[model samples]
Target: MPYRHYLLGEDQKSLLDRLVSQFTLAEESHGSLALVYLDTFDWRLHQADLRLVEEDLCGKARIDLRHVDGTLLASGDFPAKVFAWDFPPGSLRQALEPLIEMRALLPVARLGGRRDLYAVLDRREKTVARIEFLAPQVRGNEDNRQALPPRLLVHSLKGFAPEARRLADFLEGPCGLTRSETGLFDESLAALGRRPGDYSSKINHGLTPALPAGQALRQVLRQLFTTLLANQPGVETALDSEFLHDFRVAVRRTRTALAQLKNVLPAREVEAFRKEFAWLGSITSPARDLDVYLLDFPRFQGFLPPEARADLIPFRHFLQRHQRTEYQRLVKHLQSSRFRALVCRWRDFLEQPGGLEETADGMKPIDQVADRRIWKIYRRVLREGQAIGPQSPPAELHELRKTCKKFRYLMEFFQSLYPAEDIGRLIKALKGLQDNLGAYQDLHVQVETLGRFSREMVAEGDTPAETLLALGRLVEGLDRRQAEVREEFSERFARFAREENQRLCRTLFKSSSPEQA
Candidate 1:
């Protein structure tokens, strides 16, 4: 049966006292357990309307996956685990693997709580409903704890619909209870000064069309700067590859924004920051490259034949060893004075007064500036994409890919200024083409990287001949896949350049100014 959760008021009387006056109640069970909620940095489980809690009682611990309504979906003994792969195969693992792909689960909140279960009885001494009181206290460092509002969970028993409905009415009317929309997990996050789904790499600055171009671009930069800082700790600690990935993306977006929205800021200031961001980008690339290979190791192994699969173990070890080295190097650079100064100065530039200098388009309305910039980039995309042919070099496709990325970024930054549905449709069409181009480029890089790594292993010695042979097969497989991706490029580009999409793009972005509407 479905249950309901309610948040009690601070000044409310004891629930047991309120209940005793209505009916005879019997204590069912009572216990105290420490609850630690888990989710990825981006709140993956919360996004899926699920909660995973690790309950520690005395010294023993168990993990539970539950719906927001408190229904148990799965439960198992808590093990020493970081990633989902660390769990022994079970329903819990099955549920988590897909949702948290390539991300590590981290404890988002912790609370020590006591739970008391009671049975509401009828005159005939029959149990008609169950009420559970959860008294949670937020657990913090140095044995400090903060108590939160107690929650009441009411469960309906079979053949007791009227009793449950009557009890709910009484509680709502006289007891002054209300439903809790966010439940314990989010409430705990609130107590800790955090919010679920607070971190995201996507750009949504809520820019207005009539806002000054300078002010609007500053808003976007501020958000991107926040994201860049938020992901820094995770990157330094090597929590997961996604930390570095998101951090790099924030940097790229900042650079792209400054470059595309030229004249909104002083040219010299923009150029200085771009150089600093470019340096940051360069330092982070080696680690990110190795992370990609490590993350793709399983798929790379699949490319080998069954008999040769074992040979790739050495290659995996090699990647891990180098991944560590790259991370150490990356972290050192991240902690260096140069990086620190850049961060401090960049923050000041984005946040301080008098930071933005006078420029040509600084005071222009954002909608006018956005329409002009997007239209120019759209023309570039069309020209570059149309110029590609079957005989064109991979470099040409690569240049077009970069152009497409800039066009997409501009649209996303100013997406609020356009009709959502129309803009979204155009982005979807462009994404298909981008995906094909991305895959083609990635395969080419992989083929080259494999050759480079193979030579390094040989130079370092102790590399078995069979491992090289297995790598050769992997490269051969990648070559075949790259050919396939390349073959589909024409069709993908055609779809993106179809008359329908072209017309939509023009309708949405081709105008020179809001007055043109």
Candidate 2:
């Protein structure tokens, strides 16, 4: 186990001398260094109990993955600028990839410090327990004088708990050292006036069901706008595809809220903002579509033979070029004054205190409105889904997917009003059906996209015959998989529309009033 203590006194030399005299310890190593603490904007690594630091040790940059308790988990040489894919294939990359995903590992804080290493010796002069003293100074702002106080860390070697305890007792009694509540990185963050978990994109407004429909909708929209603004930096920087993905999701959710909570806000303004957001969604789609294609390229390649897979390299290059072009266009639009004005206007609208008093459903209790809308959407889903057989045209399933999305958005928006278990079951069942529909539509789109790519390749005249053949094979594979997904749809929808699920949805979401019920 690792033990940590905060030294109380200001005199470092006297403290070191006293420690040396009190215990059978010898100075082993000492160094002054600068360290940079790293984490995603959302603190994904910290939330997972992982700490990542970059430091200049031995004249080279080294990255260390440490536990929250300051125990070193893994260490490796890292470039000055590094991304997730920059880490070599090993335990560190394997461990970090899932946690950080596409977010950039940004430097959260910098600490310039000196460390002294000491080893406790047994009677036989054999090293047993170890201690480290760290004195950290804030970097980049020398005049602030906001350095982290010195700290002492005790490392208890295996089978030497007694010695560790003795040392702890002596420090607590004579040395006047107390345990520290904060870690080094956290202390550094505090010195810089920052804190962990300061930002998150999750919708966590604790709205009550009895709130007025207009007021509740405004609260929801404001939270989503906050999420949207939070992600704007990431999207503008093109830090990762997820930024745009998240931004678009916020847009979709906002649009859904506006549409679902009809007559709650000013109808004319709502419709105008709806059109503006629709425009936003349209401009974002091309880049997001390309992102999906590039992300799925590996899986697409796996569908071809090894020999044919090599041929797809040209296709990958094509995607990269197109994605860059599309993303640039998207970034330009996102950074435009028009986009900024729209978002500002939308924020003003959502933040406005009251809604039109003459509007229908504007003053109704949110629970009542939610119940009626959810039931209506669920009934529409049943009607649409039941009309489609296994042999139904793909367009029919595509339309049903849209309907399912609307129903899903309603459930998600009003989830807090109903019993958690019942709402969860309903959403879970709907998701299964939606997944099948989604896969089928995606496969169809991929097939069509590949067809267009084939034409482009032919027109370019620089592509090899083998690559075209592989592309054709890839298209056929996608069509076959699309058919397979189509086949699975009937069964998935059956499970979703089963009597148990229908009864659950009705029991939970159906209004208490007999007329509405």
lDDT of each: 0.86, 0.82
- Which prediction has the highest TM-score against the true structure? 1
Q: How far out, in Å, is residue 256 in model 1?
A: 0.6
- Candidate 1 per-residue C-alpha lDDT over 1-517 given as tens digits, one digit per residue, 9 for 90 to 100: 1367787664334766887888688988778847788899988988888988887755788888887766788778874367989888998988889998889989888888787778989989899999878888987645578798888878887678789888888788788888776667767888887888888888877888899898999998889889999999999999999999999988998999999997898788789999999999999999999999999998998998788899999998899999999999999998999999998888888775253446888888988889988988988999999999999999999999999999998988999999899999988999999999999999999999999999999988899999999999999999999999999999999999999988887887775565443
Work out the TM-score per prediction. Answer: 0.92, 0.91
lDDT of each residue in 1-517, candidate 2, tens digit only: 1565665565777777877787888888789857888888888988988888898865778888878765777778864344676788877887788888767888888777788788999989988889888888876444454677777888887687798898988888788878776677767778788788777765656668789888878888887888888888887777778788889988998888888776888888889888988888999998899889888888899999887898898888888888888888988998899898998898778777355576787787888888888898899999999999967888998999988998988888778888778888888889999999999999988999899988987887788888899999999999889988988888999999999998888787784635484
Instruction: Measure candidate 1: CA RMSD.
Output: 3.0
